[model samples]
Target: MSRTRRTLIWGALAIVAVVPIAAAAYSPFLAWRSPVYIVAGFAGIIGMVLLLVQPLLAGGYLPGLSAYHSHYIHRWVGAALVTAIIGHVAGLWVTSPPDMVDALLFVSPTPFSAWGVIAMWALFAAAFLALLRRRLHLRFRTWRLGHTTLTSVTVLGSVVHAMLIEGTMENMTKTALCVLVLSASIKTLADLRVWVIRTRRFD
Candidate 1:
């Protein structure tokens, strides 16, 4: 399929997967689980997976794409993932006022609440550091190290939060998603190590 077609297909699938959970007033399965929370959870999980897949997809895990095209696609995909994450968070807040307040205050009394808060903060830190990387006039190595550290913490915290939550994702799906998150994280670390080694060797 063409790149545009592929993008549309994936984008539509994402919407379809998320719409049911988002549109409902309450969860179909769990009476206590709100639709907004379920949708947000789905969005976050899908966003995480897409983020993991972006590099491979852009790098021609299938064939027939130029490097420029791949890079362009990667940029668009990254933006979409960020949009999805924002939607997830916003929907959750709109649906659950009490939970949102507790989560924001870091006093939810839920195992995942603290982790989610940490992840949210780490995300902001990473974004801010990226934006100011050049303005801060830090050395390339130092900036890179800080960026990677913050990103790792964010992903780790998010995974922990997702695992601790027992609402939308249940049993096998939850376990599989957790494993996918962990695997993606480990793969990213390995890729970074390879890049560092190659850079040092060239230097």
Candidate 2:
């Protein structure tokens, strides 16, 4: 493709990807919600957006960024994701403590609640393992396997949880974003192929 054509094509693709997210952020259903609900809803949106970025960074797919900077930003973004998850659950808790407790205990009436709780805990576990990698003296293969497993669960659960909730996010956009996030995560894992190669070597 010619340089100008390539630039225009990329720009169009960016717009197509971003407009839905922006529309979801300003979803009409969100307009009159209480502060706590609003905060929780937006936090969830941020979490979904972060989910998409995380794998892209890890897979080094984002253009114009060096591998060193991509990895560095990935770590920082991981921390930010933790904060976003906390804000999401905490805000919901503030709005309804009993419901939050029920969700955490895995007895929530809502189907989505269990998935969110699962993802939240998995996120924590992933971060904890990453932090203690050196101290635990884990082999690279083992650490990678465990980390990848937890992240896979986290992404899957998070996407399902978000999709099940009938909340502020616009349905079409939210679903599109969820699909993108899941695809990005799965693609990243497949590209890494850490576990696949390890198994092949053993076999």
Candidate 3:
């Protein structure tokens, strides 16, 4: 990890993480869409990008940040992730009440709706449990199990949800982002080795 190499790696990651959202911003779909819908769509795109960062931060794979700072940023990133999701859903609800209702009720005819709803709930659940883990007196193993399980559900559902839709985002960039996100998440989870973990307080 020489300084130059680390800089290159971080720069590449930044480009990859930012490209899809950048491409989406120029989408012709915006011309026909309401302003609220456009913002909602970008919120979803930003949320997907944050998913790529979350695991990289958790696993300390990014350059320049030590464990403590990385974990500290991870917490705030998680909060931003939640806010992005809320904005996405809230804007969508405002743009189309019936569609939002159908999606929320899990009875939407569109397949992606169900996946997005499931992922949204799983994400909220993971955040909620993390926030209350201390209050709940959860053991390390218990917390790890619940967190990872919810994470897998969230990743799986979100990738499927994003992939199933043909929206403002350019398809190739979206696919690349999705693949990176899934790969990063799977690698980080495998590295955790939760069953053998030592209950260290790195977080």
Worst 10 residues of 1 by lDDT: 194-203
> Predicted candidate 3: what Cα RMSD to the true structure?
1.0
Candidate 2 TM-score, C-alpha based: 0.87
Kindly list the per-residue Cα lDDT of model 1 for residues 60-129, writing each as its tens digit: 4424566567656755765676677777788888888789789889889897988987877776686677
Expressed as tens digits, the lDDT of each residue in 1-203 for candidate 3 is 89999999899998997889889999988999999999999999999999999999989999899989999999899999999999999999999999999999989999999999999999999999888988999987888789888978988999999999988999999999999999999899889776665657744
In terms of lDDT, the poorest run of 10 residues in model 2 is 194-203
Show the lowest summed lDDT stretch of 10 residues, model 3.
Answer: 194-203
Colliding residue pairs in candidate 2: none
User: Predicted candidate 1: what Cα RMSD to the true structure?
Assistant: 5.7
On a 0 to 100 scale, what is the lDDT of residue 152 in model 2? 87
- How far out, in Å, is residue 137 in model 1? 2.9
Best by TM-score: 3
Error of 2 at 146 (Å): 0.9
Candidate 2 residue-wise lDDT at 81 = 92
Please rank every candidate by TM-score, starting with the best. 3, 2, 1
Give the Cα error of residue 66 in candidate 2, in Å. Answer: 1.7
